[model samples]
Target: MKIKALLAASVAGVMFAGSVLAGTLDDVRARGKLNCIINTGLAGFAAPDDKGNWQGFDVDFCKAVAAAVLGDANKVSYTTATGKTRFTKLAAGEGEILSRNTTWTFSRDVDLAQTFIGVNYYDGQGFMVPKKLGVKSAKELDGASVCIQTGTTTELNLAEFFAGNNMKYNPVPIETNAEAQELYKAGRCDVYTTDASGLYATKMSFDNPEAHVVLPEIVSKEPLGPVVRHGDDQWADIVSWVLRAMMSAEEKGITSKNVKKLAAQDNKDKEINRLLGKDPLQGLSKLGLSADWAVNVISQVGNYAESFERNLYPLTIVRGMNALYKDGGLHYIPPIK
Candidate 1:
């Protein structure tokens, strides 16, 4: 009958989808490396070192996932992506995880068929101007030409903020953060607008960091985090828990310096024991990852705070909203037990 044919087609469609989604983990295992997408050059978030090795806060997350899944932190291949091409690259399977500082939004989550694991940084848009500009507040720049990155939430946020304030300004749009910095330094624009954390990072990269000041106004909420493609629940769970493991390690006082020792001994605390793989945590097997996954992440990548301090401290970015829940910040992860 017609109804039977329709049901068979629906079942076949689901099976095809499942087969495609299920291959990410197996493919990663077979290849022995994780292909992680990152920003072209965003200091303190994702940038290459002098040796051409990628290292930063966001880069640490990619390394952590590599450690968790592959048992080796260095077994990751980095692909630099601009804002415009990041999603397409991710959806096309060009990269397994996008660890760039991308904002989590409704359209990106549902419409684009991607899943944001969780917020790594709670950020807000702000304006930065040269100290010589003599502009103390964002509102003071009514006719200022603003340098912003194209294909980002920043462009839309800049327009809305200006219009809401009954202000008019010229937009100096660029594609990458490096480009924005170049134009801003060249005086092509009077102000540079981005996340406040990024403003500090940009300032640090300048010839004289002290010559610029980030204004106090926070224009929009940007809960930036790692992302993965949709239809792969197991892959999504693996990535999500890898991040949570870092946070939980920080909360439990396990650091890269002591993670190996902690993993070797039996701890009295149930959660610590389970997290360190002294006791088997159920459901890890379903994800096709080892029981020592959390141990690998902590020992190799350190915890969330460690990664943040190592990368962001040079930029003088404080742990305002990135601190743990007990420390009165927004980074609260679910219970590991």
Candidate 2:
């Protein structure tokens, strides 16, 4: 009976692989566009621009993947979701990639059967309050009402932070950042809490951003990145490598401005040559990508730094921990070889 059970499990595994894992690439190629799930609205991350085009750091990552896969950065159809619905939408095949500011948690990574490709942004949870409250620190808010998005780590962190500090507070549960922003503006909550990046993004959307102050107490670490469903390792590798390629291009000083020139040259840097497809890079054929996939990604989406600076720099979000490792940031790109 044990042997029979083992055989049944093996057969199930094969069937699962055949059904779910296979054909992601083929489906994407046939569709002629990459379906990316993104936040409903977050400035500097995934919000639509004034011109109605999606453009931001996270949006650029989606574009990077589309460039690598579909050969056109603009070949992406975005589906927006709230924090509670992003996973469900991704699991239901509404999108191929979730490139929002999603945190990598054990439950979501392991239990939800999703793969966090890599950390694109290192962030921490913070509190934002109107300066009219005159609270200098988070500790001063003993009985403050905090507006937090439901179905996020921010909810638990807010509870713990208040308890740990021997304080009490009222919870203002919200479904989306937009809702939270509205509640915050209406003074329904004394403070708004979320990832510091999100706080800044939300603040930027306000009529008077300077009226709010982000408290210094960072409550939790948020390792935000792109996510793909499990079972499609090939698809996962392709998306993961798109991020690596952008970072590698930045590290090698290959900007969009220079990638075209560098790809056409025969420089002595073997990695540079290999990266831009000047020379044959092994394993491209297996991934069903052209030799110039990295070239397309960099030229179209720009390097990671370019994307960050272009989208996030306006928020005054200096690349404090988001910088490359050599430059004292947490970003460390793997080898292109």
Candidate 3:
């Protein structure tokens, strides 16, 4: 009788663990695709082409996650979420992950019941103005009419920047980036402000890109990355590691073009071998992914650096803070082993 009781207890514990793991991974597999939330329409970040195919840095992150989970990068459905709706959509389980350019704020992590995962983009708030305005510095834009997106940190930052300079300005608040761009271009506002990277994207989309100049001052820290729901740890691990895999691939000189060849070769670097699945990646099977998960990511979506160069670099923005830590940037990744 004592032996039977012990056996039953052990079986029950194993069943419980298996049940929990299946709850998250099984749902994704059963659905046949990953639901990823992205920006509404920010160029070089998340935007749909004329053929309705999503393409950008944030879009690549979603594709990488899909590849890690489904072994097919194309198996992802993207949902567009604005600044006001991104968090709510994730909390409601509208998507498994959010790859929008969302900042990792303290309140957002603990109070909002979400995990930020990691920072993919190190950004700062900045302002942009038309060259016709002749504004040499952010401080010189005193009493200027400013166009800012509502429901973003930019509104608050704009207030503080102007106040800190002991100046007052008229604020023209809008809901979306398109609206803000219209207001600024139509002369309703003298300046527009947002993330510095966003400023570059917006200016590049203008009729004459040379007409606008982004201010030199950077005001706030905006560490942007992917996010997942709070309750599902297994799902979070899958998504978080997908991002880290991209960053790690970039760090180790693995790219889309070289991924297949490198995966076929034996190397002395244990981390690289394990990451490319030459050796067993211990935690991957537990995450409901194959040992070749990083291989799927690099082959499909490329590395972090590839995604950036393809999307943002074409717009002429420099990779100032987005470079790997070894390359004088902040893109550090955890070891796969």
Candidate 3 least-lDDT 10 residues: 15-24
TM-score of each: 0.93, 0.93, 0.92
Count the clashes in each prediction: 0, 0, 0
Ranking by lDDT: 2, 1, 3
* lDDT of residue 291 for candidate 1: 81
lDDT of 3 by residue, 1-337 (tens): 9999999999976654442222667777899898889988988998888898999999999999889889999999989988999887777667788898888999999998889999989999999999988998999988899998776788878888888989999998888898899989999999999999889889988989999999899989999989987888888888888888898888889999999999999978888899999988776777878878899999999998899999999689888888888888888777778
- Put down candidate 1 lDDT per residue, 194-308, tens digits, no spaces: 8888899999999899999999999999999999989888999999999999999999999999988989998878899889988988887998988889889998899998999
lDDT of 2 by residue, 1-337 (tens): 9999999999977654543446799999998998999988899998888899988899999999999998999999999999998897788787899998999999999999999999999999999999998999999999889899887788888888899999999998999999889999999999999999999999988999999999999989899999999999899999999999999988999999999999999988999999999888888888999989999999998999999999999887889999999999999999988
Any runs in candidate 2 off by more than 4 Å, and if so which?
A: 1-20
Give the lDDT of residue 136 in candidate 1: 91
- Tell me the RMSD of model 3 versus the true structure: 9.4
